[model samples]
Every structure is written in structure tokens, then in C-alpha cells.
Target: MAGVIVDTRGLARSEQNGRGSAEPEAALPDSDRPELGGALEALSGEILKKRSLEISSTSFVTIISIILGVALALLAEKTFPFPRPLVAAQSACMLLLFVCTFYYFLSISIILRWAPSFADCAQPFIITSLEIPPTYFLGRVTGWDACLAILFVFVAAGVGSTVMWSPVSHFGGDRKAQRMLHRIFREVAVIFGTGALSLASIGLAAHFAQAGKMWWGFGSCAVVLATLGALVARMEIQLSRIHAYYGVNRPPFN
Candidate 1:
């Protein structure tokens, strides 16, 4: 009887071992599974490559701007035959350009990091500021020629606004359009206010110049102020758009 029981127990142990071996055979080795790990690694590498490319492109643009700015300053110094006092004015304008460019690059870096979507919104303001110093300096040194340049700039601004408006409206949806339209009205009011202020500054500068005020020299100072006001108005509009894009509806007055 003891032999029979022992044989029975041995039979049960053999069956359990056989089942365990069969279960392992049914399950494939982890190495032989789908290449999920390799695919994910490839995807990660692609994303890194794309990010690197974008960074490179942005750096290239900034470098090009810096080079162009230097060339512009050199050409202005060599070509324009102004009086010594006017040279100071020219140098001031160039300095402003350099400052504006540096600020722009800084702003780009900040916006890219903090608010990339708002970067486009801020671009026009930078461009408008860049145009100002040259316009003001040229107007002071060359009189009516500067006004012609300013007029051309205004026309360009109008054209650019028109070109950008439709696309932005379409992309932003109805709610965004409504917000933008409201902001546009506000911007128009700001523009008018800036224009009025500019006209006043022009009159004041003309008065001072005619009075033989050596300190006032020409209308350059007034032009700079007007240009700054114009840029500020443009920036306000851009910031408003950014706010609207982000679904921010804080009070405009705030």
C-alpha cells in the first residue's frame, strides 16, 4: 500500500512539472516580441532632430539681422555727407537700431521660451520700432525726404495689416475674430491718438527750430517721440491679440 501511495504522489508531481513546461512554451520570449522599444527610440530621435533644426533656423535669422545692421551702419557712415552735428544724429539713429535689434533678439528668445504662439504677435512692433529711428533721423537731416519715407512706411503698414488680418481671423475662429475686431477698434483709436500727438510734436519741434534753439536743433527729437508712440500703439494691439489668442479676457483698461 505504501509503494502504491508513493507511486501515485510521483505521478502527480510529474504532471505538474509537465504543465509548467507547456505554459512557458505557449509564451514567446520578450526579445522576440514586436520591436516597440526600437520604434519608440526612433521616434524620440526624430523629435530631437526637428527641435534642433528649428533652433538652428532661428539662430541663423538672428545672425543675418546682426550682419545686415552692421552693413547698414557702415554704408550710412561712408555714403551720407552730413555736417558734424548731423553725424551725431546719424550715430544716435544707428545706436537705436542696434539697441532695437538686440532687444528684438532678446524678446524672441523670451517669447520662444515663455510664449511661442505670441511671437508673431510681437513681431510687427519690433519692425515698427526699427523703422522709426531711420525715419526720424532722415526727416531731420533731409526734411521732406524723410516725410516721403514715413508716408511709404505708413502705406506698407496698411498693406501688411490687410494681408495679415484675413489669415489671422480665419485661423482664430469666431470668438477670436470677435475679440480681434474689438481690439482692432481699440488699436485704431490708439493710432489716431498717436498721430495727433505726433502732429503736435512736429509743430512744437518746428516752433523750436525756427526760434533758433540750439538745443532743439532739428525735428529729430519730435520724430523720435512720435515714432515711439506709434510703436507703443502697435505693440498694444499685438499684445491684445496675444491675450485674445490665449483666451484671456481681462479688462482692457487693466
Candidate 2:
């Protein structure tokens, strides 16, 4: 559980008014006293640790984006044109990468800027807020994984294109190369789908388990999971359409 620092003076004033004739300091409950506040400061260290964990997750996204950007740039430098399906895949991947980067950057920014205020809430509120970080961390990891998966798909396409069009190569229109690329794509999709489902199930279970509590923390997890689910679903659809363009069926798990 996280620690919260309430304004003891204000709390005491209110409680005194309700009780009538009691001194403000006397009206203050032992839990709301300055000694308790000191104890809470220790608890707040745990909350700060969670915040740091999320910041580290943001760094993961940044590194992945840089690597993915370089790969895309190198691919762009090539003189050969990509097939329509590959071009579409590239565009979709870049767009989703941008969305994930922006999403994570914004979240971390809010946490850094408003965390002090959030720490001033009650004990239950502070504890409930901690529930969000686990699911949120998973969502960010999924984003990082997605960027890697996109890179893999793009690299495979580039290799397939080079194998088909290279001047010295006699393997032009190579069925084996094309099939290899397709197999890799489908396998990546299956792995991503499995991971996404596991993440969703865990998030949903957390949401329901906390729904009985009187806090908005559970709702926040639900929103995070739902938004993540939507993004992954859209990517899956785009991948499926690419498969269709190449005269292949959708991934078996889909």
C-alpha cells in the first residue's frame, strides 16, 4: 500500500467543528497526527518506486522506437520499390509505433507532474491506485513487443524481396522464399495474439477482483486493457488483410 499525506490542520478543523467545543489538535485522530504522517512518508517511498518502474517502461518504448526508426530509414534508402502489401504493412507499423510512443510518453508525463497531488489522497485511494501500474506496465511491454514484431515482419519482407530480385540470384520467383516469409509472419502474429490474450485475461481478472472495492482504480485498469485490446485487434486485422493480398488465409488462431 502507498502512503497518503492529508492536511492535518484542515482535517482537525473540520472534525472539531462537528464535535463542538473540542480543541482542533484534540479532535485529530491518532492516525491523522504528525507521527502518522511521518510513518506515511516511509510508505510513500513504495509509491515512488512504482512510479520509477513506469518511467523505466517508458524508456523501453523510446529505445524500441529509435531502433525501429533506423530500420525503416535504412529500408527507405533502398532503390527497389516494395510491393503494395509490404508498403501498406510498413505504413501501418509506423503509424502504430507513433501511437504507442505518444501514448506512453503522455502517461509518464502525467505521472511525473501530478504524482505529488495524488500522494495527498487517503490510504485506500493510494493503495487502489497501485493496482493500475501492473496492467499499465503490461500494456507498455505489449507496445514494445509490437514494435519488435513489426521490425521482424519488415526485415523478412526485405530479405524476401532481395532474394527474388538480386541480379546474381537464380532464385527469382522463389516459392520457397515466399513461403518462408509467410510462415514467419504467421508465427509472429500467433505469438503476439497469445501474449495479448494473456494480458487481457489478467487485466480483466484484476478489474473484477477490485470492482467490489469503492474506488475508481478498477475502472482505470479496464480502460487501459480495453484500449490496448483495440490497438492489438486493429493490428491483427491489418496483418490478416496483408495475408489475403498474398493469397494466404488469415492466421490460424484468428
Candidate 3:
């Protein structure tokens, strides 16, 4: 991101070069002189505001995760037993919620550590008019994007869990219907998985780029592409299996 440049040495340089001259001071253009103090104040306010919002969002997620975890635990303590598949689904949801909470906490920490600060706004510097992006862990890809991607996985898992629970399980016993539902569930899972993978890949590239390891970023990109191809093939194979079992025609993948 482009940002303000502060150059304090210009006046000193001019003074040295113009010693003994009639004009003791070099005149600076109005456009060249920016109100850095005011700019710094504005920037500081914005950073503080954003930091508060980030903390609040993470806190909300944490609280919700705790509530849901406790509720699940209580349900498990009931006398009636849950089917193994339903128990597994609920467990997966709980695990994913934990992951989402952890990811948000990590993102918040990174945001706080990198938030900009000015030691002295009055210090001589060249202030440019360019805008600077937030310097979070992922660089160009904001931390919120990655956080949302993780949450997306959690949501997808929660929705998939319905297939194993009551009401929905009524439809799950029919072989053809069950296969259809599974196909839809798998499609949704692949969609969310692909999105998360793409975001993570970009974040990894940004991380490597910031570390000055372009070679590593390139290698990771290749690996990501290979993984994506494999995901596509896996989906195709699943689709073919569903078609074979249901006596439906499989579409050509080319």
C-alpha cells in the first residue's frame, strides 16, 4: 500500500548549500507542506476505532462458541442416546467452532500488533497523499476475509450435520434420496472447501512475499494448484459413483 512520505532533511540540506546567500531560507511550496500532525491524529483515531471493532467481533464469536459448546455437552449428558452419526456430526461442528474461535483470536492479535503508531507527528517528514492498507497477517488479503472463510467451513459443517439428525433423517433412509442429499451436501462442502483453500493459498503467498521468499511462494502456489485439481477429480469421481448407484446418466467431464 502507498502511504505518506516524511522527509525532514530537505531544509537542512538547503541551508548547507545556500550558506552566505542573501536568502537564508529556502521557501517551501504550500502543496509540499502537509499538516502531518493533523494527519497523524486522524490516522491514530481510525486505527483505534478499527482495533475496537476487531476485538468486539472476536469477543462475540468467542462467546457464541462457548455457549454452543456448553449446550452440546448438556445434551450429551441426557439419558437418551444419540445415534453415532449424529454424535459424530455434532462433534465435528464443535471442533470446527473451536477452530473458528482460535483463528479469530490469532487474527485479532496480529491486527493489534501491526496497528500503526506515530512517535512524533511533528517530526519533519514528507507526507504523501497515498492510502495505506491495513498491515495484518495476510497483507493484501485482510484478516477478516480469512476469518470469514473459516466460519464458512463451520457453517457448511453445521448444515451437513442436519442430514444425520431427526426430521431430516426421515429422508436419509431412502437409498436414492439419501444419495441425492449426499450429492448436494458434498457439492456444498466442495464449494466452501474450495473457497477456504483459495483464501488460505493467497494468505500463504502474501506471507512468503513479505518474508522475501518469492521462491517459496511459487512452490506453494504450485502445490495449491495441484491440490485444487485433485479436489475437482475427487468430486467428479463421487458424482460418477452417485450416478452409477442411482441409475442416472453421468455427465462428461472432458
For 1-254, candidate 1 gives per-residue lDDT tens digits of: 55664458888999999987778533878776666456544457768767655674475456546655654665366436654554565455445545544543443242222212344444544443444345334424344224424533453354335433344443445656545544543454455345435545554665545554333434544455454446445645565565566677633325
Per-candidate local distance difference test: 0.48, 0.42, 0.44
Q: Report the lDDT tens digits of candidate 2 across residue range 128-235.
A: 222222321222333323333333344333323333332322225665544443443344344445444544554345445634422222333333344445545654
Best-to-worst order by lDDT is 1, 3, 2
Model 3 vs truth, CA RMSD: 25.3
Query: In model 1, what are the clashing residue pairs, if there are any?
Result: none
Tens-digit lDDT track of model 3 for 1-254: 36977677998888877764544234555666555455544457778878766765455445544554554454445312543432333333333434443443343233222222241111111111000011121112334234534544553564355344323343445556565545645665666566556656665665556664434333333433443345455545665555566677776353
lDDT of 2 at 111: 22
Best by TM-score: 1
Which segments of candidate 3 are over 4 A away from where they belong?
A: 1-159, 162-173, 176-210, 213-227, 251-254
Candidate 1, after superposition: displacement of residue 207 in Å? 16
